[model samples]
Target: MSVLETFQLAIKNILSSKMRTFLTMLGIIIGVCAVIVIVGLGNGMQGYIEDSFADMGTDSLTVMIMGRGSSRSVSEEDMYELVEENSEYLKQISPTVTMMGSVKIGSDTLTATSITGISEDYFSMKGYEVVQGRGLQYMDMTDRKKVCVVGQYLNMAYFGGNAVGQTLKINGNTFTIVGVMAQEGSELEEGGTDDCVFVPYSTAARLSYTGTISSYAITVQNTDQISEAKAVVEQKLYQVFSDDDAYTVTSMAELVEEMNSMVNMIIYILAGIAAISLVVGGIGIMNIMLVSVTERTREIGIRKALGAKESAIMRQFVIEAATTSSLGGVLGILLGYGLSALATSVIANVMPDTPITVSPSLLAVVVAFGVSTGIGVVFGYLPAKKAANLNPIDALRYD
Candidate 1:
C-alpha cells in the first residue's frame, strides 16, 4: 500500500478497537497534563513574586550598619555626602529609624500602627503621595519638628478621615499630623500597609533616644544602573569602616533577582519530578503495542501472503501508535487549560490579597505535544519491528 493508504488503514484498525486504543493513550494523557499544570503553577508563582518586589520598589537600596569587631561608625552626614559625591548614579538618601511603641490617641492605644522616622525625600523616593495637607519638608528635619504623617488606615480608624492637623502620641511624645498618605492597599485593615505613621528622621531619633542612625534607605537615579550605585555605596562604606562586616549594602533589584532564581530552581525540580510520568507512559505504549502485534499476527500473515512488504507493515503500526499518542496529547492540553483556569479562580477567591493567575504558555503546550509524539515513535519501534518480521509461511492453515 502507498503511505497515505497505509495511514488510513492504520486509523481504521485503531478505531476498530476503541477501548484498547483509549487505554493505550491514557498514560500519555496523564503525563502531558501533569507537566503542563506544573509549569503553569510555576509561572504564576514567579509572577506573584515579581509583583510583590515591585511594590517594595526595586529601584532602591537599603544599608544596615553593624560594626562587628570594629569601633568605627559612619555618620548620617557621611551617607548624604556619599550620595552627593556619586551623583552620577545615586539620587536620594534617607535615614530610617523604626520606633518601638504603640501610638496613643487620648485614652485609646493603637497597637497596630507603626512609627518610623524618615527624611522629606523618602516620600518621593518611595513614590508615596500625600492626599491631604502637605508632606514632610527640609525644615521639619532640620528643626527636629514633632510633625508626622499618618496612613489611610490609621486616619480613617481614629480621626474619621480628617487626620490632617490632628495629633497622635508615639512613645509618649506628642506629634502633630502634617499630612495623610493616600491609601496603599485595597482595604484598610489592621497592621496593613496603610496603618503606619511617619515622622522627621531627626525627631524620631530624639524620641527613640538613639544618637546614631544604623539604617539608611537610598534610591538610585537610574534603575538600570542600580549595580553601579550599590558598588559605589559599598565602596564608600568600606573606606569608612575598612571592614566588610561593618556595613552591608543591599539593592532591592538584586534581592528580586535572587528570589526569582530561587523560585525558578524550585519549579525546575518539581517539573523534573512530574516528567517521570512521561517515561512510564512511554513504557505503557510499548507494552500495549507489543500486545497489539501478537493479536494481529494472523492478519499480518494474510497481508504478507498478499505481497505486502515488511517496511509498509512497520510504517503502518508506527503511524497508528503516533496518531494515538498525538490525540492523547491534544486532550491533555485541553484539560490542562481547564484546570489552570479553575485554579486561578479558586486562588483569587481564597487569597484575594495575592491573586496568582495560573497561565500556561504556548511554548509549554508545543513542547508537551512534541515530546508525547516522540515517545510514541521511540516506544513503538520494537513492536513494529516484531510485526514486520512475522513469518508468512505455514500455508495459512495453521490458524
Candidate 2:
C-alpha cells in the first residue's frame, strides 16, 4: 500500500480503538505538560529576580567589615582611609549605621522604622527619587547635618502629607525631614520607602553611639573595572585596618551570577524528573503496541497471505504507534501552556511587584519535547515485526 493509504488505515484503526489510543497517549501528555510547566516556572522566577536586582540599581556594591579572627567591628577612620586612597574607581561611598528604632511625630509613632545613616550617593545607588523637598546634599554631610529623608509609609503614618519640612524624633534625637522618597516597588522590601528614615552618617554614628560604621555602600563609575576596583579597595582597607581579613567586598555582578547558577541547577533537576515521565510514556506505548500486535495476529497473517510486504505491515503498525504519541504530545503542549498561565497568575497576584515572563525559547522546547515522543515507535517495532512475519497457513487454520 502507498504511504498515504497506510496513514489512512492507521487513523481508522486508532479511531476504532479511541479509548485505547487515549489511554496509551495519557503518559506522554502528562509528561510533556509537567516538563513545560516546571521549566516555565523556573524561567519566570529568574526573570523576577533579575527585575528585583535592576530595581535596586545594578552599579552598586556593598562592602562590610567582617571580624579579624572573630572581631565584629571595624573603625570609621579605617573605612575612610580606604576610600580616600582608592578614589579613582570609586565614585561615592556611604557609611551605613542601622538602628531599628521608633520615630515619633506628635501623637503618631511608627515603631517598625529602619533608621539608616547615609550620604548623597545613597540616593542614586539605591534608586531613590525625591518626591518632596531635596536629598541630603554635599553640604549636609560636610556640616554633619541632622536632615533626613523619610520613606513613603513613614510620611503617611506620622506626617500625613505634611512631611516636607516636618521634624521627627528618632531614638530621642530630632531630625528635620529634607526629602520624601518616591514609592519604590519591591526595592522597598520592608514596606514603603516612607516607612524607613535616612540620616547623615555622622549624625547616625553619634545617635547610635557606635563610633564605627556597620558597613559601607560603594558605587563604581565603571562596572567593567569592578574586579580591579575591588582589589584596590581590599588592599587599601587592609593597610588602614591593620587586619587583611577585617572586611569583605560583595559585587552585584557576583551575586547575580550566583543566582543564575542556582536557577540553572534547579532547571536541570526539574528537567531530569520530567525525563522519567517521558520514559514511562514510552514504556506505555511499547506495552500498548504489544497488545495491538497480539490482537491483530490473525489479520496480519491474512495480509501476509495477500502478498503484503513485511516492511509495509511493519510501517503501518509503527506509524500508528507514532501517531498515538504525537497526538499525546500536542495535547500536552496545550495543557502545559494552561498550567504555566495559571502559575504566572497566582504568582503575580501574590507578588504585584515581581512579574513572571514566559519566553519563546520555553515554547520551542515544549514543541521539541512533543516531537521527541515519536521515538515510541522504536520500542513498538519488535511486536509489529512479530505480527507481520506470522505464518498465513497457521493463521487461517486457527479458530
Candidate 3:
C-alpha cells in the first residue's frame, strides 16, 4: 500500500478504539500543559522585574562609598567635580543622604518614614515628577532651606494629598512642604518611593547628624554611554579613595542584565523539570503501542498471508503511533494555553500592578509538538518491528 493508504488505515484503526486512543493521549496532554505553565510564569516574572527596573530609569548610575578600607571617602564636592569633568557623558548628578524620621500632621504621626536628602537635580535625575508645587532649587541646598517635598503616600496619608503648602513636623523640626511627588510604586524589596520625604542634602546632613555624604546618583546623557560614564566615575572615585574596596559604582543597565540572566536561568531549570513528564509520556506511548501490536497479531498474520510486505506492516504501525502522538500534542497545546490563561488571571488578582502575562513564542509551541511526535516515532519502532517480524503461519493458527 502507498504511504497515504497506510496512514488512512492507521487512522481508521485508532478511531475504532476511541477509549484506548484517549488513554494513550493522556500522558502527552499533561506533559505539554506542565511545560507551558512553567515557562509562561517564568516569562511573566521576568517582565515584571524588568518593568520595575525600567521605572527607576535605565540611564542612571548609583555610587556608594563603603568606607571599609580607606580613611577618606568620595565627597559631595568630589561627585560634583566628576560630573563637571565628564559633562559630555553625564547629564545631572545628585548627592544623597538619608535618615529615618517621623512625619506628623497635627495629632496624627507616621513613624519610620524615609527621609532622603538630595540635591535640586534629584527629582529629574531619578525620573520623579513633581505633581504639585515646585521642586527644590540650587538655593534650597546652598541656603539649607527648611523646606521638604512629601511623597504621594505621605501626603495622602497625613495631609489629604494637599500638603504642598502645609507645614509637616519631621523628627520634631518643622519644615514647609514645598512640593508633592507623583505616586510611585514599590522597589524590589525596599519600600515604595511614595513613602519617602525629600529635602536638601545639606539639611539632611544636619538632620542625620553626618557631614560625610557617601551616596550619589547620576544620570547619563544616554543609555549607550553608561559604560563610559561608569568608567569615568570609577576613575574619579579611585582618585579620592586610594583603595578600590572603599567605593562601588554600579549602573542600572548592569543590574538589569544580571537580573535578566538570572530569570533566564530559572526558566531553563523549570522547563527541564517539566520536560520529565514528556519522557514519561513517551514511555506510556511505547507501552500502549506494544499492547496494540499483540492484539493485532491475527490481523497482521492475515495481511502477511495475503502478500503484504513486512515494510508495509511496519509503516502502518509507525504511522498509527505517530498520528496518536501528534493528535495528543495538538490537544495538549490547546489545553496548555487555556491553563496558562487561567494561571495568569489568578496571578493578576494577587498583583494587579504586576500582571503575569503568557508570552510563549511560536517556536516554543512548534518545538513542543515536534518533540512529542518525535517521541512517538522513537517509542513506536520496537512495537512496529515486532509486528513486521511476526510468523504468518503461526499467527493465522493462533486462537
Candidate 4:
C-alpha cells in the first residue's frame, strides 16, 4: 500500500477503538504535560532571579573591610584614592554606614524604618530620583550635615507625602528631610524597599561612634569590565590589609551568575525527575503495541498472504504509534500552557510580591513533542517487527 493509504488504515484502526487508543496515549500525555510545566516553572524562577539582581546592578561591587585586627585600617580616603587612581576601570564609590535606631517623627516612633548613611553620589549611582525637594549635596558629606532623604513609604505613610522639609530624630539626633525618593517598589508597603532613610556617611560615622568605615559600594566604569575592576579593587585592598581575610570584594554580576547557576542546577534536577514519567510512558506504549500485534495476528497473516511486504507492514504500525504519541504530545502542550498561566495567576494572587511568571518556551514545547514522538517510534518497533514476521499459513490453520 502507499504511505498515505497505510496511514489512513492506521487511523481507521485507532478510531475504531477510541477508548483503547486514548488509554494508550494517557501516559504520554501526562508525561509531556509534567515536563513542560516543570520547565516553565524553572524559566519563571530564573526570570525572577535575574530581575532581582538587575535592580541591585550587576555592574556594582561591594567591599567590606575588617580592619586587619585593628592594626591596619583602610580609610574612606584610601578607597577614594583607589577609585581615582583606577578611573578607567572604576567609576564612583560610596561609603555606607547602617544606622540602627528608631525614627521619632513627631509623636510616633517608627522602629521598622531602615536607616543608612551614603554619599551624594550614591543616589546617582542607584538611579534614585528625588521627587520632592533636593537630594544630598557635596557639602552635606564634607560638613557632616544631618539632612536626610526618606523613601516613599515613610514619606506617604508618616509625612503624608510631604516628608521634605520635615524633621525626624535618628539615634537621638534630629535630621532634616531634604528630599523624598521616588517610589522604589511597584507599590509602597511597610518594611519594604520604600521604607528607608538615607543620610550623609560622615554624619553616620560620627553618630555611630565608628572611627573607620568598613563598607563601600562601588560602581564599575563599564559593565563588561566588571571582573577587571573587581580584580583591581581586590588587589589594592589585599595590598592595604596584606591578608585576604581582612577585606572582601564581591561583584554583583558574579553573585548573580552564581545564583543563576544554583537555580539552573535545581531546575535540571527537577526536570530529570519529571522525565522519569516519559520513560514510564514509553514502556507503557511498548506493552500496548505488543498487545496490538497479538490481537491483529490474523490480519497480519492475511496481509502477509496478500502482496504486503514486511517493511510496509512494519512502517504502517510505526506510523500509527507515532501519530498517536504525537497527538498526545500536542494535547499535553496545550494543557501545560493552560496550567502555566493558572500557576502564574495563582502565585500572583497568593503572593503578589513574587515576580515569577510561568511561561513555557517554544523550544520546550518542540522538544517535548519530539521526545514523545521518538518514544513512539522506539517502542513501536518490536511490535511492528513481530507482526511483520508472523507466518501466514499458520495463522489460517489456527482459525
Give the number of the best model, judged by TM-score. 4
Q: Per-residue lDDT tens digits of candidate 1, residues 40-62?
A: 98889888888888887899999
Candidate 1's C-alpha runs over 4 A off are: 68-71, 394-398
**Count of clashes, each model:** 0, 8, 0, 0
TM-score of candidate 3 against the unseen true structure: 0.92
**Candidate 4: tens digits of C-alpha lDDT, residues 1-399:** 898998898889889889988888888888889888888998899889888988887889999988667678888999999999999999999999998888888888888899999998999888889999999998999999999999999999988889888999997899999999999899888788999999999999999999989999999999999999999999998887888998889998898889888988987788778777777777877888888888888888888888788998899889888888888888889989999999999999998989689988888899999999999899889888887888888765644
lDDT of 2 by residue, 97-175 (tens): 7876788877767676778888777887776798989898878877888899988776665667669888988877788
TM-score of 4: 0.97
Candidates 2 and 4: which is better by lDDT? Answer: 4
Model 4 misplaced stretches (Cα beyond 4 Å)? none
Tens-place lDDT per residue, model 3, 1-399, is 999998899889889989988889888878777777777777787787788888888899998888754467666887788898889998889988877767777887867578889999888877789999999999999998989998888777777768888998888999999999887774321246677788999998988887588888899998998999999988877776667888888899989989889988988888888887788888888899899888888999999999999999999888888999888889888988998888888778987777769766566688889988998898889999999999999889866
TM-score of 1: 0.96
Rank all candidate structures by their TM-score, best first, as comma-separated numbers. 4, 1, 3, 2
Q: Which runs of model 3 end up more than 4 angstroms from their true locations? A: 68-71, 186-192
Worst 10 contiguous positions by lDDT, candidate 1 = 390-399
Whichever of 3 and 4 has more TM-score, that candidate is 4
lDDT of 2 at 258: 87
Task: Identify the superior model by lDDT, candidate 1 or candidate 3.
Answer: 1
CA lDDT of every candidate: 0.88, 0.77, 0.84, 0.89
